[model samples]
Target: MKSRDFTKTGPVAMVAHACVLVVVVCLLGAAVSHAATDEADSPLTVYVAVGVLDVDEISSADQRFTINYFAQFRWVDSRLAHDGPGTIRRDITDITAPRFLILNQQKVWSSLLNVVDITPEGEAVFRQRLWGDFSQPLRLHDFPFDKHTFELPMVSFGGLEQQVIMAPDPQRSSLIADNLSVADWRILGYQTEVREIPLTNDVSVQGFVFSFEAERIFTHYVVKYIIPLFLIVMMSWVVFWIDPTEAGSQLSVAVTATLTLIAYHIALAGKLPDIPYLTRMDLFLFCSTLLVFVALVEVVLTSRLARSDRVELARQYDFYSRMVFPAAYLAAAAWALL
Candidate 1:
């Protein structure tokens, strides 16, 4: 039976099928676009307020004061965006960015500025946000979020420059700053200002402002630890004055000088971040210790020669000790200054 041939009606059926497919595609496209628009227009608003207060005395002898500042972040709007897998909402469950907050904390040298502390008070500010999530373990190269302590030098005036990442998650929010760069969702800008917050007790605030950038922190290290340590090492090389024949006295002086340098290294290491490579301070300390050790070795060698048959050699050694050591040390100091 030429059954009512469906093949003869193929063109009409094909046209109807195509029309239905098009309508479904159009509806799906509209839904996705509407959802995207809603998310894009939604505003994720966070409010941050800061209060500065005194913490405690850093040191009695130095007349140094430690101050603490509290920062509070409140999540004002969670409906600003829709959450999806691998989205910003998922990434920043704690609302705090992985980057550091730059603060003004240096009080010693005018040209040096950096962060001083990242307290629980500050972390609490970030924790209050519903999006806060910092469950990942911090790697070595990861930015540190803790109290940054600084021993101010004798000087009193300094300024701090801090650059904080307002929004680092690209899929989340926009940042507002004139000199800022935005990529993906990271914002980079600098905050440069002179801060002078007076303590309640009239003690000078020994700490500078805090910030997220590393350059500001390392600048202080260069000026306070590296420069001063270099000078001290050069000064220690002056021990070459005692005669090699007075080997016992020379050894005593050298050992004492070396011990002093070791003490300095210990103090410096306690303050500075632990790193494997030689810092500027480390270089200076090592050089100073080596010079003292060399002087001790020379004294021992010259004394042994004098006990044997080389008294003249011992005398010559004393001559070099007077001239060569002083000259070399002076030259090194000059080079370092340059």
Candidate 2:
């Protein structure tokens, strides 16, 4: 048996052998390790874990309200957790919280800045406690019987929608404390949602919006403004019962009612915020004022008729005015309130 030496092999054969060796070595290198290091990896996206909100309290006075809002935020950097931080957590301790707002005041929201915690898995926890006055463009057109939906959004300041996303908690959408104190405004339940709002710079960002629906307790408004106005209008109606033969007495009552109604309307107007359009209350007041003025005119006309020696005609006209005036007032009220 003769053994062949590789050195004695032909040049072409040796070249082919070397090529096979090179291929095997390259494949092994790829299988064993990657060229890039762990530190070289950068995070492109941050996913916020589902969170819970604990609302402390809510109180409102017509336009704006005070809220003690608290929430917890969990942010995960999965890529960083797997590589940069193996078993231990990363901490970026700072005094500032991550957000800006469109609906709340900067001064008040600044105080809402909270603490952060980063776990071993690159999970950042943000604990927030905020107390501030939030304003809504109240559609008080249906005031006292109005239902309102108000939004409180915690918006991301610099994070773009592509870079960061907010995930609403499946377990908890909104958690409101029982016995929330709002005297005139009834505190109904709320809903939580994840939203993307457009920024001035043409980019959009993610946020958590908590919407609260509330109903105004009608009894208070009825007691404060509506009943008083009704009483005054009734006082004016007293002229209808007065003798048409006494012109001095009739004029005195009419003048007194007119002045009193004008004063009531002015005072009530002062209580409301300056709105450009008419409200349900405004329409009612208008109808009431018109009725009172018409009543005063009726007194004037009837007294004139009596002085002209048509006493029976004056009495009949006065009787019709009372019925027609009240009926029209009632109809106008239905149109406005209903």
TM-score per prediction, in order, is 0.40, 0.75
Q: How far in Å is the alpha carbon of 256 misplaced in model 1?
A: 2.1
Q: What would the per-residue lDDT of candidate 2 be over residues 1-338, giving only the tens digit for each residue?
A: 89989999999999999999999999888765453333224323323332223333333334666666666665555433444343443333332224434455332453443445555676666655666677666777886578888777666554322244555655344566666656666667677777876555787667767777878788977888888877877778778878799888888887887898888778776556877878888898888888888888888898899989998999998787778777787799889878
lDDT of each: 0.43, 0.66
Tens digits of lDDT, candidate 1, 146-261: 12233211112221122221222223322223332211122223222224434456754322232221112244555665566556554544445555456677667667767777
List residue ranges in candidate 2 displaced over 4 A. Answer: 1-62, 78-102, 106-113, 159-162, 171-173, 198-204
lDDT (Cα) of model 1 = 0.43
The TM-score, computed over Cα atoms with residue i paired to residue i, of candidate 1 is 0.40
How far is 68's C-alpha from truth in model 2 (Å)?
0.7
